[model samples]
Target: MKNRFRLNLFRFVLLLFVCVSCSQEYDKALEDALNLAGENRPELEKVLRHYHGDTLKLEAAKFLIRNMPGHYSFADTTEVKPYYDEVDSVLTTMKGCNVWTIRDSLVKIDNKYADLSPEWVEDIQIIKADFLIQNIDSAFVQWKKGAWARHLDFEQFCEYLLPYKAEELQPLDAWRTYLREFHPDHLDELRYCDQLKNSSLQSAITLNDNLWYYMRPEITEASQVRPIYRLSTRLRMPFGICADFTNMAISVFRSQGIPVALDFTPQWAFRSLGHTWNVVLVNNGKNVPFSGATSNPGQPHKPDERMAKVFRITYAVNPDLKRLSEIEAFVPSAFRYPFFKDVTEEYMDCEDVEIEVGDSLDGRYVYLTVFDNTEWKPVDFALIKGSKVVFRKVGMNSVYLPVCYEAGGQMKAIGHPFLHTYDKEVRPFIPDTSRRVTLRLLRKYPVLRHVQGVVMRLDSGEFHASNDARFREYEMLYRVTDCSVTGREVVLPDTLGAFRYWRYYQPKNGSYCNIADIRFYERATGKQCVGKIIGTDGCWEGNPGHTKDKAFDGDLLTFFDAPVSSGAWTGMDFGKPVDIGRFVFTGRGDGNSIDIGDWYELLYWKEGGWHSAGKRKAETVYLLYEDMPRGALYWLRDLSKGKEERIFSYEDGKQVWW
Candidate 1:
């Protein structure tokens, strides 16, 4: 009896210790939040007291209050509301119109309101008790009643479904209720189909496919204005960029009890800009990635797409990033917020990269940067330990540079740029001055194999001339047997007679008459001949700018696209017989090829940054750079015009793209 009494006393003491520790922790956190609330402290206190009767709800309220210090919304709604209103008005008026036609008006609207700046207010200072309560109750209903969300624990529920706003600058409104009923029939098919009712992935796929019918992805000048504040405004617009689409998906999915999060790469490993997409958490704890309104779940990215690092956005602060702040280290704007977690291993095979700085420790933080078009941008950060810094779980097969930020945030290179090769080897581009090689560059960017197949459609195409507009009786002018990136000019036979009507007929298996420019030359004066544009009546999607006249518009970037897949033709009519000396035609292309008479500059990467080899004017289809440095990363810039360029390494007389 004495021993039993002693055991009971010990259990009581342990329970008392745990309760006291939890209370102290909660009290400290609440004090810090209330101190930051200032004049809004009473609103927070009201939320806490309202949930005092329910232990679980009280903990939930505390969770939100503790994390509220860094959350914010737009303070000056009056200044920014007009921009959203104007954009929505324009989009509503132009409904069902082609995206190209709506682009100009959107650009004008964005430029008109470019000077408006909205102030930010912290959630701790501006959030109201009623608003917080509504969000919490709505989130709890979905979590308790949602069939697809049964696998989520309390922590996962708080991070993925409980957040009031998906992104910063969002207005504090009742978005959950509005979005829950936004698409009444989006999941009707899923409910009727027995195979899909039990699977969350299939339900997500069905919903995304249905959303694609109403909304599509479009990149325009106005894409810079993202994270549209009003949910109704975003729903009214039919087109949006990747980030806008992802935000919309988050709002819709989370409201219906599907756990979703946004994952992104700061910059693509092989391309110019970054990409954002939605990831739905499944019962197996795996994230299924899909473009919100453009692609379905389980659909893979294009083969050319590459990622060097992927991050998942979270509402909870990252402990690792918070530690960086504790040490007073400089953090880049890409990682300034503590709401992201590195998730590279979930997407691809990755390994830890330990870069040796060789005694040059400029600061406590070292960064890994990727070349983004015109400059090198930091994508990942690590701390210096002695002379080396180790970055964990870095994706492979990309070029990276190690650098440290000095005072004023100027980046200073600490080592030469190196390639994280696919074979898991670090090959640094240390220029060997003793060795040199001549580079014969054909294009600024690598031609994708699929796009090259589109260029090959011109083969076997026939050019004919006839007095009959129907071309029933015609004489063959020329038959193209091969195609080139820079196009070709073929001299017509002198014996060939002139005709009133001339046209190029697409082959049966060819793409929809995808020709960029076509010109006829006079035999007598050798001058270019002009005629009235005539051909297909409608373009792809009835776009005005993609009609038959685009072939004669003198813009290589513009091309004629036919509504029909085959037998569509674009040519000119002289109204009378006229002799043609030569024919020149260019196939539809991305305009990244070397053009005659355009200036270009070749650059190589050294210890510091890109150094120009020399500028030269292209006299032929390709540029020739003599005595260039061997074993280094190279970049070709079009000095005349163009925006798409990529880095490459010359090997075996050909450019190997990253």
Candidate 2:
């Protein structure tokens, strides 16, 4: 008799859970949900009554109850109250539509139907994608038998109607208007690329191939060219950054009814920068990811870097992500998606990494940081529950440290770096216990601001741009993927010659690599190489104010420029020539159009005239491996009539353009 009584109690509790989970008593839920209707409650009531016996009415009511509170949290409830007619209009049509289709979309729209107040459902984005297309204007082409929907599943189909919004770019409607006006008949052509064999891959490839060359990436001021209005807008100025490319990709894909989302890393684990790209949901049931705007699907230029984390944007509300906003996660309001999916695994190898920290727990968030040359950069973060903080699905083959972002946004490291091996092994590097380890830390200083540059040691003093990597002897040391304002550390080599010369290779992009100093330490003894700036090729080049000599003036603000022609040359005569081991050259940074040589020849004056040291095909701030004799003039001759390049140089122990 006692056992039977216990079982009965358990059954009653279980039944109660089910009822509460489904929004408590149905009548109360229905009544409360209807109350949000205000003046339109009568119309809503009429629609609910029309489908009284059907489950469609209850489902419609549940969606409103689950999401309306969240919508009101941001917007004025009173102001949006009149929108109840729009709500009723959609609900009325649901009676004739497929019930499960609506239910599936609602499940994605709002995860919780029961327990409807902001705990499980703090954020709500009722993606009225279906209603918007089906009921709104008939400008959208028919989905049935159309090229857009023929390859998509039900979920992928919804991504089209769900508008993509990022940053403060132009409204998607304006993008649509431009597409219709300009490329009315090109839709079919934009759906497939001939190179790709897979029909599923065609859509993305087509979008990229059609748009890549058309919207050329020109370097422009960020303030002048944003909220890009249309293809015509880009045509007027034909340039943009990664963000602009992503926006264009979103606009193009969505306009054609393809499923695409913008995914980005807050910060790169290896590089001191961040990037954004597009992921398209193809017919193969897998997302074909690409570096949108700059690269097309399956291209060689696609970003294949190991991203630490990826956050996808969605038009629908994500409940968990929404809660982070309340807890002061510092996530941008635009980033507060209806929902976001972490798809890092799809792009790269990832593992759940846990760092053991012996400290008292606090509500403050702990972060996973990667050593980006000079400082530890926070890439991913999580709340500290106890002494352990776990970073989920981090990419392998990089060094990471556990840290916390303190008040005022200062990042404080909690532990030393541990290498995450490619084979999925976590190995910590303790400084004391090592075999022939790094003897001393070298050059941990900032040299440039938001720049990308290369470091090299002189393989030859010959200044030639050659396709043969060995033609000009500047052995690459390291690549500063993202040079920062605070600077960076130049990782030194294990072994160093007694008299070594190094040069910083700044790319010909529009940013100056303003290096304050260059320091190299003898690996064994820890002795520093005090490099002095000698002179530049500016004295030999054309025009005043823009002569090659400005390159050696020790000022980033000044640069050299010459006419676009072959045989254009610049050189430096190291006074009373010393055995030259290296030449340092900086690209012109004032504008994007300044031509830099792609192919050039390095010549040294030996027998009273310029003699060929070697030929090179590409120009970089290089240290030629071969040591040239003293008293000989060194000059660079452009083989191609492209943009004139800026050149800076240093000899043996002296700086090139101090």
Candidate 3:
């Protein structure tokens, strides 16, 4: 009995010591924040005193205050508010207008505010006590009452639910209350859904389905405009870019007590521009990604899409990032902010890459970069240790370059470009100049599966001619057997009879008679034939520009996309029966293919940048580059025209797209 009593007493003393230590740490952090608050210290103290009676609320208040020094908002909203107001007005009044017209209007508005500069004010200095109290109370109410939020612990709640704003520079307001009350009717069915009651993912999917009906994503020139900082203004707008939709979704989900976050890739491994989306935290501690108003959770990305690294935006400052900023004088823009956490391993398999840097160039850090069409963009960074640098959790099956940033943000290559193969092998592109090989390139960019599908649709299409306007009686003048990237020409037989009407009838297997330019020639004259455009009453998506006449409009970039997938055809009416000798047709495509008359430049990766192999004018469907460096990453650029090109490697006499 005596031993038991002593053991209990010792346990109690230890527990009390731990609790007191934790409290002192919290108080120290709060003191630091108050010292930095300057004139706003009293407002923060008011919040602390108001929540003193409730232990949980007091802890929550401390969490917000401790991290408030780094959080800031735009100091001046005069120029920005009017911009969002005008955008909201335009989106409201021009609802259902042509997408292009609305985009043009938004672009003009964006330009008007392009010169506006941003000035920032820290949240700790300007935030009010009443606003913080209300925000805390509302957050606690939702966390305790919301069924989908039961799985989240106190840390998750603080990170995802308690934050007042989704991003920096956002206008602070009563967004939680407004969003919670705005669409009470939309989620009524979800409340009654027994299977979805406790499932955060399902609830998020159901809410997204309802929200998508009213909101949409539009990639417009206005996307380049200064961000709309007001959540209410964003809600009022009909459409927005990926980041806009993501921030809006985060507001909505958190308002309903669902733990959500924003995830993004700084740059795609295989293409230009980055992408952002929303993710819901579930019971298993896994995040499921879904595009707001676009796709459901677990939907696979497009086949061509690849991610070299993914990061999750967080409300708290990352300690590692803060350390990096302190040690390095200049950090790349991608890592300049301390509000992101790397979550690449959660999305795909990753590998740790260690490269030897013979010369560090007097730099302390090196970055792993991926090609972004026009240039190599840094996706992840590492510290230079001794003669080597180690990049952790890198995505596989992509090409990467190691570079060091010099003064004024200039990147200097420190290591050779290498491919991290899917089988977990690293192969450097050393450029074996001792041997040379010839390359026959088909296109600047790889023909993706979808593009190939469009090309294959031209097969089996039949050309018919008849006197009847309805083509009730017709003769099959010619049949298309194959099509190429440039196009195909079919020579009609000499015995073919003339007809007043001629049309290229689409095959049932074809995808909506998707044809670009088509031309017909008169027999024995070698002269192009012209007539009234006929067939296909409506175009896809009701776009007037894609009407049937576009097939004969002599523009390869535009095509006649039929509203229906079958029985759609476009052709010319001769107005009189005239013998047709041949016809030329091109398929709808991305126009990255080598054109017969276009000029192209072939380059290879060497040392730190691209070195020109040669330039040639394509005389055929493909370009031929002779005596090129073997075992090197190649890029074929269409100097004549194009904006889409990718880096590729030649293996076994074929171009392997990275």
lDDT of 1 by residue, 96-183 (tens): 8888677678778888987877789898999999999888887887777765676778888887888888887777888888887766
Question: What TM-score would candidate 3 get against the native?
Answer: 0.83
User: Model 3 misses residue 172 by how many Å?
Assistant: 1.4
Note the clash tally of each candidate.
0, 36, 0
**Residue by residue across 1-658, what tens digits does model 3's lDDT show?**
9999999999999999999998898789789999999999999999999988999999899999998878889877775778888998898899888766776888899898888777899999999999999999988988888777888888889988999888888777888888886554446566677877778888788778766766655644236555777877776555567888888889888888878999999999987888899899986788888977677777765535778999999888787788778877678889988888999998889999989886544348788999988899999988877787889999999999998886578888887889998888888998999999999887778776667767866777778889999988999877777665555567888888788898988876546888887888888787888999999799889989888999887666788888888788988888899988887777788777666567889989898789998888965456778888899998888887878899999989888887
For model 3, the stretches where C-alpha displacement exceeds 4 angstroms are 1-30, 191-194, 219-225, 301-304, 359-363, 449-453, 461-513, 517-555, 560-586
Give the whole-model CA lDDT for all candidates, comma-separated.
Answer: 0.81, 0.46, 0.83
Worst 10 residues of 2 by lDDT: 437-446
Of the two candidates 1 and 2, the one with more favorable TM-score, higher being better, is 1
Clashes of 1: 0
| TM-score to true structure, per model | 0.81, 0.53, 0.83
Q: TM-score of predicted model 2?
A: 0.53
Give the top-scoring candidate (lDDT).
3
- Model 1 scores a C-alpha lDDT of 0.81
